[model samples]
Target: MRFIINILCCILAFSSCTEIKKYHSIHAGPKPIAVVIERNPGIRVTGSETPLSVLYENGTLIYSEQSEADIPFYMKKELEPEDFKILKNEICMTEKFKKLRNSYNLCPNILGSTTVEIYMSDGKNSKAVSVYGYGIELEKIHDRIPYPDKNDKLPDEFRRIFRKLTGLNFIEAEKWTPDYIEIMIWPYGNAPEKSANWPSGWPSLSHPLTRKRGDSYSLYMPGLEKNDLNDFLDNLKPKQAVLINGDKWSVDCRFVFPGEPLWMKAFNKMQ
Candidate 1:
């Protein structure tokens, strides 16, 4: 009878484990639990880039930074489970952070600057803050904008939270490999004098997969080959236009980091 009871217990335990695995595989991929994003309207006119930092539910952290030469670099690291637990507890359990109001939007500086946003959610209590601090390069025209000429400082508590999430001093990340590359294309015209020649193997403007996005069209390049991400994007930058098939075209490359849905078209809503 004792042997039979032990066998039954093992069967039940295995069944429970199988169920949990199925649920995780289907529902709990690395959903974006938090992100630090800075959008520069000055960059592409419509403006987009990788978020500065993204913290995922499964302990994944993705970071992107711009080099002194204006080149972009990306890296990723998986936090220790215990470290992620502590960070999540700090964010979710703190009443002040949980109760803070949603937005702190101010207009960016003159000549062009955009909003910086921080968003965190533990499934239920979500905090989204948008801040546009005063730009030191302000001109008289700054007074003419919709936002105030002088921006108010964020309260100290919120300031520390922002710093903590962004300051990944402990994390050491490897090169980021994106799941997809979203390329927004505009027709050839007024092209920059310094432009990268069209890359071979890129889909044509009218490729079947190209979809109309407002005035322009978009194409996605999947990172199939292990080295495709670095190999394909090496010479391309939004600063320089592209001459494709003998025509000058504007191109914006936006990284689609893992676990986040299709380029986050609703990204502005987070602000």
Candidate 2:
């Protein structure tokens, strides 16, 4: 009787393992209809850094940046179905990607500079992964694998999957420029002793005075010319704002430009 019981236990264990394998194979297959990648470069002393968002859905791709009001300035393009199919296949074949853990913090602190969040859905099932810092080192450390290079941006498998999915190399999308630029300025650490002075070299405006809302101020500058925007960006000094805050705090400034989705809403509001 004891010998028979041992045989039954082994069979049950084997059956359970097989079921687990089958479950992963079915759920991990190519099924994502939409993917969104949000990249945050983190804060820098210069305060000139901006976050980026890339969205892929139904063969359409969009790259965007966020404004102060949480509006997005975007550039969009259409993609081929074949290319998307290739990306889906690559992702499904990655062993580590079978069912990503809900969350991962490769490095809790220290040398982290960027955070990437990936969201995917197939109109039925969905998965999300938040990668903190460069993924290469984190993935290795998490899996107890030796790191060949500390500076590697991502694991080989992930790099390939992202390259195919994002189409970073194949982007031939048209650039989108805004008709007018909106600027928002606010205190970062401490309230300013007095009103902050506008940077010099900015185009003179009939209403250059900033409008106060709560503790922050906003300025609207009208210029659609590419060169004009470039000049404004070049002259704007984030470091100066940091100094104005007693060198202890940084100024929060957001530059808003026109783009899809939000662009239409902004235009309608103007009209």
Candidate 3:
């Protein structure tokens, strides 16, 4: 009789443990420490688009632009937990939403697609949504997920949420431009070393060389106008020939415009 009672008690304990596990799984909420929104500004004549990125983390908001010039300028502001409540609610980072998003197929042939990525506090879990065209599809999916109909315009709710989070109206391109322009120069392939004596006709601007790799260098030229940049490029002549370790080498100039902070950070780490 006592053996039967012990067996029944063990079964009851196992069932209770299973129920507790299920309850916690269903009630778990998203604990997001940081959120990043990134998108291209649009196609340019140069066949390159500048990227706009907004990062919210540690109660601070940072807006970064890498369009007009090489170095990106960051504008930062302090934020409170309340500032993110609306965005968090709108993101709806739950297991069900993630499953639906993963199953949904993003529309192809999209012109100027935007990628919105969210990162949780643990940094292991993340969710991403692709916005095609003007984000009509994104709105539709958000409005009627599990079965959404396509639309032409972005949802008003999404626009409001983004504007509040980034403090910029994305609808207007003119508003995205900052007052200052930044320029960066990267020299590769047996580039000439800096001269100890300044050139006679050299432009009086700060050109600090940041090493990129073995025998390569990057220079940062900040706060310059269009005319100033044009003049500098016109006067700067490519090295005709270079002698490295008794071998004749010719240098080529290639400009790299990093569209995202990730690339920029990687470049900064070189050397």
Give the top-scoring candidate (lDDT): 1
Q: Model 3 RMSD to the real structure?
A: 17.8
Q: Write the residue-wise lDDT of candidate 3 on 1-271 in tens digits.
A: 9999999999999977875553333223323243444434452211122333343334444455444756554454444478556545554344443543321223344445544332323245544433344332354455453333453334343345444444532222332222223332222345464312222332223232222334343223333343454454455456533332233333322222222333333222421
TM-score, ranked from best to worst: 1, 2, 3
TM-score, one value per model: 0.67, 0.44, 0.36
Candidate 3's C-alpha runs over 4 A off are 1-38, 41-53, 64-75, 81-97, 100-124, 135-271
Residue pairs in clash, model 1 = 188-248
For each of the candidates, the C-alpha root-mean-square deviation to the true structure, in angstroms, is 12.2, 19.1, 17.8
Cα lDDT tens digits for candidate 2, 175-270: 555344445555555434433344454422324333444665444554354455455446645554432323222334343322222222222232
The residue ranges of model 1 lying beyond 4 angstroms of the native Cα positions read: 1-29, 66-70, 92-94, 105-111, 134-151, 170-172, 190-197, 206-209, 224-248, 259-267
Report how far off residue 157 is in candidate 3 (Å): 9.9
Cα TM-score of candidate 2 = 0.44
Candidate 2 lDDT score at position 223 = 34
Clashing pairs in 3: none
Error of 1 at 86 (Å): 0.7
